[model samples]
Target: EAGVAQSPRYKIIEKRQSVAFWCNPISGHATLYWYQQILGQGPKLLIQFQNNGVVDDSQLPKDRFSAERLKGVDSTLKIQPAKLEDSAVYLCASSLATGWAIYFGEGSWLTVV
Candidate 1:
């Protein structure tokens, strides 16, 4: 089984610029999550998806951040007019929908200058 795949691996942007990240979770997994991990902190749940529908997005900043899983297979997260505080590693994880050990991708590290 393939693990989650995220790209660019790293990003550098100026404050208030727009950026987007992509994720491909493990096949057959029913649960997908997007987390923002600041340096030295735990991964914060930005959004969670159950198949094609969103299950939890309360932690996501609606003002500038948004994510979607169109066909329940792949997902994309975007931040418009990025802030300096938004600089962090954006990770994507997948689980068996039962709280099993979630597998994580290498993450896309965004740095806003």
Candidate 2:
């Protein structure tokens, strides 16, 4: 079985530039998640989606960050006017909506230059 896929494993941008990252969850998985992990910190859930609908996004900074899941498959996250403090790893994980291990992708590292 193929694993979760993510792109732009590394990115460098100015403090005010906008950036986006993509994610492709595992096949047949019904739950997808986007997390932000700062250096030396644990992953913080940014958004959680069950199929095509959002289940939780309370931790997401809606004023500057946005995310979406399309057709219950791939997803994308974007940061507008990115801030220096936003430098961190964006991790994508997917689960089967049942009792099982959650698989994570190789996170996208954003560096505010």
Candidate 3:
């Protein structure tokens, strides 16, 4: 009945600085995701987690980004040496299954200047 929860509703960092985002998915959900949305664009899947393991991270930019799920409930995403182009909204989403409609959190707005 509840939705996904994300913290630090907004973040501002200079280019090359680091930032982190946290997310807690809805209870009993089996899949979680991290997405990046540039203004006027659809959210791009950064990583996918099924339970406590990674399901897909092919789209993630590993050179500057990392993510992890803890015990299949909580997750965190980090970006080091962030770039100006990293300014965007970071979304956390969850679904009951792989193909289910995902419920998204209010999103973490990042500003890299």
Estimate every model's Cα lDDT from 0 to 1: 0.94, 0.95, 0.96
Which model, 1 or 2, shows the larger lDDT?
Answer: 2
What TM-score, over all chains together, does every model reach?
Answer: 0.97, 0.96, 0.97
Q: lDDT tens string, model 2, 1-113?
A: 99999999999999889999999999999999999999999999999999989999999999999999978899999999899999999999999983567899999999997
Clashes of each: 0, 0, 0
Q: What clash pairs does model 2 have?
A: none
Query: How many collisions between residues are there in candidate 2?
Result: 0
lDDT of 1 by residue, 1-113 (tens): 67899998999999989999999999988899999999999999999998989999999999999999999989999999899999999999998784777899999999999
Top lDDT model:
3
Find the 10 residues in a row with the least total lDDT in model 3: 1-10
What value does the lDDT take at residue 28 in candidate 1? 88
Off by over 4 Å in 3: none
Query: What ranking of all candidate models by TM-score puts the best one first?
Result: 3, 1, 2
Task: Report the lDDT tens digits of candidate 3 across residue range 1-113.
Answer: 78899988999999999999999999999999999999999999999999989999999999999999978999999999999999999999999889998999999999999
